[model samples]
Each structure stands twice: as C-alpha cells, then as structure tokens.
Target chain A: MNYNFHWRPVMKALPELLEAALLTLQVAALSMVLGVLIGLGLSLIRMHMKGPVRWLATTWVELARNTPALFQLFFFGFGLGAVGVHLTPYLIVLIALTFNNAGYLAENFRGGFKAVPDTQIRASRSLGMTAFQAYTRIVIPQVLRIVYYPMTNQMVWAVLISSLGMLVGFRELSGETQFFASKTFRIFEYFAITAVIYYVIVKIILGAASLLSKRLFRY
Target chain B: METTSRFFSGFTPNDLWFLAEAAGRTLWISILSIGFGTVLGVFFGWALSVTKTAGTLTIAPILDIFRSVPLIIQLVLFFNFAPMIGLRLSPFDAGVIILTIYTAALVSNVARAGIEAVGMPMRRSARSLGMSYWQDMRYVVWPIGLRAVFPSWIGVALGVMKDSALVSVLGYVELLKASQILITRTQDTLLILAIAGAFYFALSYPISLYASKLEERWSQ
Candidate 1:
C-alpha cells in the first residue's frame, strides 16, 4: 500500500476528457435515435409480416442480442473490413451501437406493442382514421409511452456499450482515457477519473430521463 | 485478392482446439463469478431487506457505482489499481473479482425484488407457525422468492457471460480474445468472427429461449 497517488496529470487533461465525454454522449444519442427508428420498423415487420423479410429482422435482432456488444463492434470494425468495406472508427462505433440497440429495443418495442390492446387499433380505425393514421395517431404514441422507461434504459445501455469503442480505436471518452493513460503510464489515476466521469454522465442521463418522463406522461 | 490469398490459410484442427479451450475458459470464469456473485447478492439483498435505511445509505450507493460504470473501465481501473496497492493479481483473477462484484450488484436488485415478492404477511405467518427468522426465510421465502426472480437471475447470468468478453481487455484469453489472436495470426477475420459468434450464440440463445418460455408458463 505504499504506492504514491498522482492527480496532477489527470487534472491537467480534464478538459480533453470532458470533450471526449461529449463525443461519447453524441455517439450514444445518435445511435439511440437510429436504433429507435429501425427498431420500430423491425417490431412492426415482426408483428405483421411473413417470409424472408420477417426472418431478416428476426435474424438481426437475435444476432445483436445473442452476441457480445464488443463482438458486434469487432464485426463492424474488422468483419466488414474483411469484405473490403472500410469505415472510419467513429462510424464503426456508431453503426455497431445502432445495430445492438435496435436489436434489444425491438424486443422491448414488441413487448410494448403486445401490451396495447388490439381493440384500440380497431376503435381508432372505425373513427374514420386511416390505417397509417391509426398507427401514427393512436398506436405508436401509446406504444412509446409503454416503452419509455425501457427506452431510457436502452439509452443508458447505449452510452455504456459505446465504451467498447475504445477497443476499436474510436477516440471517445474511454479511448481518450486510454490514450492519455498510455502516454503518462498513469493507468490507475486516468481510469479512476474516467470512471467518475462516466458515473456523473450516467447520473445526469437518469435524472434528465426522470424529469422528461414526468412531463411526457403527465395525466 | 492478393492480401486475401497471402493470409487465408485454411482453418486447422489446432485452431479448433484453441477456440474450444478459450470457450471453456469463458464458461469457467462465468460460472465461477456467477456462482459467487449470486450467493453474495442474496446475502446483500437479505441485508437490504432487513435494514432498509442503512443498506440504502451504504451498500446501495456502492453497488450503484458498479452498475453505473462500464465494465471495461472497472476492469481497467482495478487491473491497474491492484499492483499499486501491492496485490499481484493475474488478469484472470482481477477480471473474475470485478465481474463478481458487478454481477452481485445486478443480482442484488433481483434478489431484493424476489424477497419483497414474498409478502410481509406471509413471513409473519411463517413466524407464527413457530419458525425462527432464518427458518422462515429458508422454508417460506427462499423457494417462493427464487421462483419470482428466476428469469431475471438468468438474464443477469447471461449478461455476465456476455460481459466476460470485456475481461479480454485485461488480457484474459477468453473467447473473444482467442478469436482476436487467431484473426491476427490467420487474417481470416470473417471466418474467425463467424465461428466465434456462433459459439456465443449457441451458448446464449437456448437458455434465453427457455427462460422466456418458463416466464410465459409461470405468468399463465
């Protein structure tokens, strides 16, 4: 227990860490947006479609869920590269996170959809609403409400999974920490602070989600 | 085509053995951590249920930190922090230690919910039947509570198994790390990744399917 603590280097690089934290949030938020859109489509297809199209969506969801997020990130990073489709590291993280998020969120959305009674859709349809209008105006809004908490959980997951970007050389928060830690050989100190930063980011997201939920679900 | 030809040696029997060993390590570590974590989690959960305010003030926040931070960061920090404090832990040991705590943190909540699912009235009834507190918990609560949270416990266990891949960051040669090494050596990235992913999917999918089926049955 005689090792000396070093906080100076970590403090000096706090600004860079903060910037990288923002990048982490950006990638997470962006992936969550894409994930929700794709997940909704996938859930619908799974619910109503047949043949290979539904199979494709099912495969996507299973593969994403059944594998490790790091493995998925590698698939996007190196697996695709094997077929000669090279992408930037940022795009790699973005695409991989989106794929993983969509998979999990699709399942949650499916559960949410199931919880909404079929009678409601029929009720809306008989109210002179078109099928699309019934879905958009009646079904989706309720489904979103039902799945709101899960979506918030997914967003938190998105942020956490984005940390895998470090392995693939994406210069997000964890990657930035790795970079500085390697240079300074202050592995413990650098990662210690990075962990704190991640904790604060997660807390903020949770707080904001709670506040947003109160507003959105106000009766 | 030239690069592909240069690196694409056919997959050998040795590589299969390598992957099998790696998969075994992955399963071994997961089983070890999950076993210890669940036991510890049940204890923590019982403590939390028994002493609500004290547990929330002390154990809850500590567990929250484990849940909040990414596993990779926790691994990295603990891996480095170990040597500084004069503990000479191997990568596997450190990975298992952190993962156990992480699993315990998650399982604690599930365990708590399970305990709570067995209502206070039921516990009181058990006590009135001349059961001691421990006997009441063992006979009345444990069976019922375990049933209530079995699916969630499975989810946490499966999650911890998948998350064990992150331990590869600490230089433990689990399944993911094994594939990476093979990819570097053979440069057959697609083949290696496909096999590795299949191994994971095979290990994970059946159990999850079974859990969901069990959940459906129980709900009915």
Candidate 2:
C-alpha cells in the first residue's frame, strides 16, 4: 500500500510509447492482409481437395489453432534458426501472425462457405461460367458477406496478439512499456497506460467495424 | 549433414518422458482453469440474464479490458502486483488464476449469448406452467441455452488449453518452457517445438473434430 503511483515518467515517455503502439497496429494490419490471403487459400484447399490433399490444410489449421500462438511464433522463429535460416523479429512476427490468423479464419471462412448453398456454384457453372468465374462472380461475394463480422473479430484478435511481438523483442507497444517500466521501476504505471492504449485500440476497432458492417450489409 | 543426423539421433527416453511430463502439466493447468472459468462464467451469465443490476453493469467493462489485454501483460502485472497487495502466490498459482479470469470472461460472453439465444417464448411458457423463476430457468432456459452454448464452449476450451502455454513466460515449465530448455541443451529447436506442437495437437484436435461433428449432428 505504501508504493506511490508515478505518472510523470510515463507521461514523459508518451511519444515513444505512442510510436510503438502505432507499430503494433502496423504489424497487425499488415499481418491481417497476409492472413486473409492465406486463409482464403486454406479454405479453398479444405473445400476442393480430397483425401490427403485436404488433410494437409486441415492439419495445418488444426495445429495452428490447437497449439499456442507463442509456439507457432517460436516454431518459425527459433525453428528456422535451428535450420540456419534467420529472420528479423518483425518478419518472424509477420510470418507467425499470418500463419496463426489464417488457420482460425480458415475455419470461420469454411463455415461461411457452407452457409451459402452449393447450388449457387452449380447454377453459375451451368449458366456457362467456368469454375473460376463461378466462384469469382457468384460464390466469393456471398462468402465475403457471410464472413464479414467474423473477419472483424479476427482483426481485433490480430491487434491483441501483436502484443506477443514484444516477447520476441519486436519493440511494439508492450515491449516499449516493459523497457521503460524496467528502467524506471514503474511496472504498474507503464503497463497501466499501455493497457489503456490497448483498450482504446480495441474499442476503436469494434466501433469502426460496426460502422463498416452497418454500411456494408445494409439490406 | 552430421548435425542433421545428430538432430535425428537426439532421442533419449528421458527426453521423451520430460515431454510427456510437460504435457501433463499443461493439461493440469488447462483443466483447473477451464473448470473454475466455466463455474464463474455460468454464474455471471445467469446474473446478467436475471437483471441489469450495478454488478451486472460492472462485470462487462471489466471483462472487456481483461479480454482485450494480452495474456502476457496480464501475467506480468498480476505476478508482480501480487506480493505488493499482500497476496503471496507462486507463478503457477498466478498463471492459473489469471488464465481462469481470462477464460471466465470469454465464457461469460458465450454463456450470456447462449441464454439470450433461448427465445423468450420458452421462458414464458415455462412460467405459465406454474414454474417459479428458478424452476423455469432450470427446466427451460438453461437446457435450451446450453445446447447453443456447447459448440462455442468447446472453442473456448481449446483456446484456454492452448493459451495455458502463455503461462510459460512466468517461468512455469509447461510444454513451451520445457521445449525452450530442451532446445538450449539439445540445440534442436525445430524438432523440439514440432514435437511440443504435436503434443498440443494430440490434446486439442480430437475435441475440435468432436465439436464440429456434434455441430453438424445438432444442426441436422
């Protein structure tokens, strides 16, 4: 009870901390873009392939989901180093986040694909559209609509998880906070502000998602 | 090529047993956290459904921040803050407590949504059948709500299982921590983490498959 709260040290370090927070968002945003592309590929692999071909994608997604994201991050980070392939922390995080994000979103997108009946694809194909055009013109747009909300949730997840970049020494917001907190011996204060920043970021994501969803899904 | 051979030959019975033991610790932590989380979550969900009281209002924002904040930060904060507040707990205990809180927050939302998904008509019908509020909930609201909640709960359970790995950062030598040690000594980081991930996959994949199977059955 005797420990006093110190705000001055944290306030003075605000600019650097803010910059780190932006870095967190930047990595998250970049990973999300990569993740979506990977996830789409995963869903397609799961949907179209048979036997072991489908199982390959299933195993990848299940491993990503079932194991800790930390392990995935370390697996690629340290695992690759063990094989003499070195990647920077940012690259490691980007790759790991994309891998993990694609796995989870693959499941969500798979579900979204199911909700859109198979007959539509068949109908598009029968109407002289090739398989590629059938998917492009008919199936994918509906799949996007179906998965939009879940994609928003994934965005929030992507941002929240970017904090793990700190563990790998990526110098994101939480990493910056830890550095200052350790330096000033203000573990509580530094993390407290960082927590607030994280909270605001999540709220903004949810708020912006709802706005976008409202417009995008107007019926 | 020699080191590659060494990596493959790096198998010892003792190392295998160590991995098994680490898997046990991971399962133990996950089981305890999920049990506590489900219990508290059900309570909060019930409370939320019953009324919009002050505590009900307070529960949500608290869950929001807890849910949004990364598990590592929470662990660091709680592990450090414990002694200062006169609560003495080992890292294992701290990890369990925080993981339980994190799981409970997510479960609470799932439970609340499940409860709400049960139509008002079912509750009203039960009430009109001479059932008290508790009787109505027990016989009608809960049964229907739980069905909807089951699949989502499975997802949360898998999440908590994997997330327990985060406790490694606090020096609790679960699967990931154990792998880190083995990696240092054996210098086989890829194989060790790959083995560790297989253990996790062994633990989680069956349940995920089961959930999906059940979802298909239930929807049918």
Candidate 3:
C-alpha cells in the first residue's frame, strides 16, 4: 500500500493526449456520417425492397446488432486480410464502426418510420409530387426529426466504441494512453486523465446536440 | 482467396469447442456482472425514486459519471490500477467488478424511469386503499414498473453481453479473446471471426425475440 500518486507525467503529456482525443472525435464523426447514410439505405431496403436484396439488408442489421463491435472489427480487418484484402487499422475501425452504427440505427430509423403516420406520405403523393419527391420532401424530414435524439445517442456510442481502435493499433486516445502509460509506467494517472477526456467529449457532444436541437426543433 | 486457402492448413476442428468454452465464459461473466448490477441497481433506483435526503443528491452525480464514460476505459483503468492500490484481482475478477458497476449505473436509470412512469396517481390510489408502504410497492408499483422496465432491461442485458467482450483486452479468455488467440494461431481470421459472431448472435437473438414477444403480449 505504499503507492504514491503522481500527476506530473500525465500533466506533461496533456497536449499529445488531447490531440489523440481529437483524432478519436474525428474518426467518430466520420463514422457517424457514414453510418447515417448506410442506416437510411438499410432501413429503406428493408421497408420497400423485396427478394434477396431485402434479405441482405435484414441479415446485416441482425448480425451487426447481435455481435460485439470488437468481434466485427477483427472480422472485417483480419477476415478481409484472410482473403488477400488487407486494410489499414484506421480503415478497419472506420468500416467496422460505420457498419455497426448503421445496423443499430437502421433499426431505430425503421421504428421512426413506423411512428410517422402513413397518411402523411399519401397526402404528399396526392399533392402532385412523385413518390421520390414525396419521401424526400415530406416523409424523410419527419423521420429525421423523429430519429434525431437517437442519432445523437448513436453518435455518443460511436465515439465511445472508437476506443476499440486501440486494440487494432489505430493510436486513438485510449491507444495513446496505453502507449504513454507503459512508457512512463504511470498506468493509473494516464488512464485516469483519458477517462476524464472521454467524459468531457461525451458531454460536449450531448451539449452540442441539445443546442442544435433547440434550433432545428423549435416550433 | 489464396490466403484463405492457405489458412486451412493450420486450422483444426477442435478450435470450435475451444471457442464454445470461451463463449461459455462470456455468458458466465455476463450473468455474474448483471446479477451484481441488479442488486445495487434496485437500491440506487429506489433511492433515486424517493428524493428524501442529501444521499440521493450525492448518489445521482456519482451514477452520472459511470454512465458517461466508455466501459472499456473503465475496465482497463480498474484492471491496471488495482495493483497500485494493493488489491489483488485476477483479470476475470477485475472485469466482472467494473462491468457490474457500469451495468448497475444503467439499471438504476431504468429502475428510476420505470418507477416514475408508473405515475403518482397510481401510488396515491394504492395508499388511499390503506396499503402500507411495503404492501403498496409489492402489490402496485412492482407489477407496473417491472412490466415497463422489462423491455429496456433486455436491451441492457444485450449491451452488457457485448460490453463483456472488452474484458478480453485484459487477457480474460472470453469469446472475443479466444477469437484473437485462434486468429494468431491458425490465421483463418474470416472463419474464426464469423463463428465468433455467430455465437454472439445465437446468445442474444433469442433473448431479444422473447422480450419482443413479452412486449406484444402485454399489449394484448
């Protein structure tokens, strides 16, 4: 029990660790953008498409949601490498995270779609708009609004899950913390600092989301 | 494809059973973690539901911190730091302890919300019927609140199972860790990884389906 707490090593590494935290945020943001698009596509395919195409959509959502993201990351990275399709660790995490986020959010978006009344779409259709126009102009807006908070939740999840990048050697915040912690032998201090950073990053995302929602959702 | 073909040479069928054992470890750890969480979660949830004292205010912020951070970071921190604090913990012990803390945080939220969702009028009506506090809760609040909470509890259970994968990083030989070991040994990443994913899917899908059925039945 003679362990002495030291913060000096962690203090000196703040700038470097903060940069790594920013990288974590960047990867998470990029994944969120990709995930939303893929999720929307999956939801539409599951809803409107038929036959094998729809089956593919259904399978991706089920498999992704049911499996651990770590498993998916390894499966995508090494699995592809097993087939002579190598990917960088960065690409591996981005793709795995995007796919995972898409799978979860596709289901969320599907529920959002159900929550919207069918009459809204029919009304837009009868107003001389094409089916595509009706969906984009009328239905999609409502779906987006309905899923906005859940989208924020997914964004937070994507940020947190990106820490798995550490395992795959992507050098995000957690990876960088491990690197510094081992080098300085200040394991507790290094991890303690990064945990605070993660907490702050999540708070910022939630804060920004609420601020943005205040504007977009104001009636 | 050639790499995949070459990988077949090092692979053995028994690795499937090895993974099955690992999957069993994953489930075992999940049950222990969630079990611990349920006990503390109910206490904290009940505390948060009743805003009677300074204790509730203090506990709320502490729970909020646990909820905010990633579980992986928490797991790694606890595993690495326990030695410094002179507490000896095996990787499995450390993993289960930290995950239980995280799970309890989430479960408490579920409990608090579920209780609130039962509404005050229902509680007041039960009180007017001359039921004691314990009797009122046992008869009225528990039934309604638990029904509302059941669906979300299943979601948390699924989440805890996946989060358990993170314990593998600390050298706990769970399903994900077993997959990593197999990959390094056999080099058949695609097959190994897919089988691991299938194991997880098998574990979670039925729980989700059953929860959905319960939700539907309640509607009926």
Candidate 4:
C-alpha cells in the first residue's frame, strides 16, 4: 500500500470528466424525451389497435423489455453495421438507449393510461369533447399524474445504464474514471469519488423529480 | 442445424468449443452473483424494514448511498483495495463481489415491497392466533409477502443476468468480454459481437418472459 497519492492527476482530469458527464447527461436526457414519445405512441397504439396491430406492438414491447440494453446496444452499434445501415458510435449509442428506455417507458405509460379511469373518459366525452380532444386535454393530463413517478424512476435507471456508453468508447464519466484509474493506479480513490458523484447525481434527480410531480399533479 | 452450422462456419470445431466454454464463464458468474445477492438482499431488506423505527436511521441512508454509486467504481475499488487489505482475488471474483453488492441493494428494495404487501390485517390475524412475533412472521407474513414479490425477484434476476456483462469491464471472460476477445483477436467485429449479443438475449429473455407471466397470473 505504498502507492503515491497525487491529487494533481485527478484534479487535472476533473474538467474532462465533467465534460464527459455532460455527454452522459445529454444521452440520458435526450433518450428519455425520445423514449417517452416513442413509448407513448407504442402504448397508445397497443391499447387502441385491434387484431394484428395490437399483436405487433405487444411483441415489439416484449422483445425490447425482455432483452438487456447492453445487448441492444451491441446489436445496433455492431450488428446493424453488418447489414449496412451504419451509424456513428454516438448515434448508435443514442438510438440503442432510446429504444431500450422506450420499451420500459411504454409499459409505465400504458399503466398510466389504465389508471385514468374509464369514468373520466366517458365524462369528458359526455361533455361534448371530441374523442381526440378529450384524449389530448383530459386523458393525457391525468395519465401523466400516474406516470410521473415511474417515469422518473426509469429516468434514474437510464442514467445508471447509460454508464455503459463508456463500453463503446463514448468517454462518459465511467470511461474517464477508467482512464484516470489506469493512469494513476489510484483505483480506490478514483472509483470511490466516481461512485459518490453518481450517487449525488441520482439523489438530485430523485429530488427534482419529486418536486416536479408535486407541481404537475395537484390532485 | 443451419443456423448453428452457419454460426460456426470457417471455424474449426475447437473454435466453437472455445466460444461455448467462454459463454459458460458468463453464466457461471451471473448465477453465483445472483445467489449471493439474493441472500444478502433478503437480510438487508429485513433489517431495513424491521429497524426502520428503532432509531438507527443510518442503515437506510447507507442503502441509499449504495444505490447511487456506479458499479464501475465498486469494481475498481475491489481491484485496487483487495491486495492492500490482504484479501487478494482475481478479477472474476472481484466482479462477483461487486455485482453481489449491487444486486443486494436492488433486492432489498424488492424485498421491502414484498414485506409491505402482506398487509396489517394478516399481521393482526397472526398475533390473534397466540403465535410469537417471529413465529407469526415465519408462518404467516413471509409466505404471502414472498409470493407477492415473486415478480419483483424475477425482475432483479433478469437485471443481474444483464449486469453480469458488466463483469467484462474487469476483464472477466464473460460473454461481453468474450466478444471483446473475439473482436481483438479476429477483428470480425460484426459477426462475433452479434453472436455474443444473441447468446445474451437467449440467456436473459426467457427469465424475463417467465417473470411477466408470473406477474400477470399472480396479480389476477
């Protein structure tokens, strides 16, 4: 344990890690937005569509939800290129994450849709709201109430999972930590701090999400 | 036969054997970690639940602390710290320890939900039957609560299976590590990585589907 401890190396690398953390946040945040939109569409279609359409959406959801996001990242980042639909490394990672989050988010949103109660939908319809109008103005707003907590939870999961982006050379926080650990061989100090940083970020996310839920869901 | 044979093309039977052997390492690590994780998690969960009002709020905060930390840091910590602590282990062992801790944290959450799901009425009924508290918990509360949490346990199981791939970062010869090996050795990036991905999908999807089925059936 006679290893030399230098704060200089890690401090010098801190800015780089911060930049990488921004990339990590970007990946998680953008993927979350896209995933929600994709998931909402898929869940709405699954709920309303009849016959083969419902079957298709259900199967798609099952496949996505069941498989690990890592496998999905590999399949897209590596496998799709084999078939000639090549995307850049970052784009592949982004798409992989979006699809991964969408599968789970679709389920959360679907649960939310169910939680909105049939009586409310009927009430809105009886009030002369068109089907489309009622859904946009009433159903979506109410569904958001039930969906907010779970979606936020999923967002936290997404942030953790996005740590895998380092695997594909995305140079996120984990990736930078790996580089710093190797350079300094101060693995304990580096990893301990990285873990703390991640912990702090997730706690902040949870706090913000709870606050957002309070403001958005008054009822 | 076609798929298997095509998957093995231009490679000797020995090469295919090596791939399967490497895949075995992946499954072995995941299963071992999950087993360790489940036991640690059950205790951790029970401790968290039973001690919530005992004025030791430290445990829950620690659990929260563990949940927030990244897995990579844990692995790195073990890799560097073990030798200094006189508990030297290989990268594979280190990965298992880290994964076990990570899985334990998640499992405790799952277990807490199971405990809460059993309801106070069930607890009250057990008390009214003249059973000691531990006796009642062993006989009455645990069964229903554990059954209710079967789906959550399965979810965690699936999660651990996927997380086994993270062990690759430690240079373990898991599926992801094997993929990296193939890519480095052969440079047939697509074919080898795809094979690795399929192996993972094959391993993880059944557990998840079964869990979904259980959730659907039990919730009804």
Please report the TM-score between candidate 1 and the true structure: 0.97
TM-score of each: 0.97, 0.95, 0.95, 0.89
Provide the TM-score of chain A alone for each candidate, in the order shown: 0.99, 0.95, 0.97, 0.91
- Worst 10-residue lDDT window for candidate 1 chain A reads A1-10
Clashing pairs in 3: none
Candidate 4, residue A50: the lDDT equals 90
Q: Candidate 2: misplaced stretches above 4 Å?
A: A126-128, B1-11, B53-56
Q: Model 3: per-residue lDDT, tens digit, A91-205? A: 9989999999999999999989988888988898888899899888988888999999999999999999999888888899998998998898888889999999999999999
Q: Ten consecutive residues with minimal summed lDDT in candidate 3 chain B? A: B1-10
What would the per-residue lDDT of candidate 2 be over residues A21-124, giving only the tens digit for each residue? 99989989898898888898999999888999789898878877888888888987889988999999999989998998999899888988888899998898
DockQ of each: 0.85, 0.75, 0.76, 0.57
Sort order, DockQ high to low: 1, 3, 2, 4
Better of 1 and 4 by TM-score: 1
Could you list the chain B TM-scores for each candidate? Answer: 0.95, 0.93, 0.92, 0.89
Better of 1 and 2 by DockQ: 1
Per-chain TM-score of candidate 4, chain B: 0.89
Q: How much does each candidate deviate at the interface, measured as C-alpha RMSD after superposition?
A: 0.7, 1.1, 1.1, 2.4
* lDDT leader: 1
Positional deviation of B62 in candidate 1, in angstroms? 0.1
DockQ of 4: 0.57
